[model samples]
Target: MPRYDFRCRECGSTFEVSRTMNAASDPARCPDGHDDTVKLLSTVAVGGRGAAPASGGGCCGGGCCGG
Candidate 1:
């Protein structure tokens, strides 16, 4: 089961929901009778501290003595 984000135009409400793929395929309409409701493109990311650090260069903090 994957959570999805939906945007409601009738009430301008953007909310998240956890449901099955079937339910996710067919999203429910806005309770306020707004047909403009649509699924928003989003990705579920995990920002955690841990694992291995980057061996390459990144922004200001990269290789030795970046000026």
Candidate 2:
């Protein structure tokens, strides 16, 4: 399962949910009980991009050291 972040337009609430990739695009209900929620764009720390690379890294992963 993968985690997804979502924001509710009706109540301006933010939340996270764990679901299968296939269902990742499905509409999510906000924790505040709002159904008008949209998926939030998340930042993935790919190797060699985003933040500074680890001391022994091949890509920049904040500190994940994926490289």
Instruction: For each candidate, give its TM-score against the true structure.
Output: 0.53, 0.66
Clashes by residue pair, model 1: none
Number of the top TM-score candidate: 2
What lDDT is reached at residue 23 by model 2?
A: 97
Off by over 4 Å in 2: 48-67
Q: What TM-score does structure 1 among the candidates reach?
A: 0.53
TM-score of structure candidate 2:
0.66
In terms of lDDT, the poorest run of 10 residues in model 1 is 51-60
Residue 16 CA error for candidate 1 (Å)?
2.7
Residue-wise C-alpha lDDT for candidate 1, range 1-43, written one tens digit per residue: 7888888977998877788987886866766767678899886
The clash number for model 1 is 0
Q: CA lDDT of 45 in candidate 2?
A: 58
Q: After best superposition, candidate 2 residue 14: deviation in angstroms?
A: 0.6
Error of 1 at 47 (Å): 7.1
C-alpha lDDT of candidate 1 relative to the true structure: 0.76
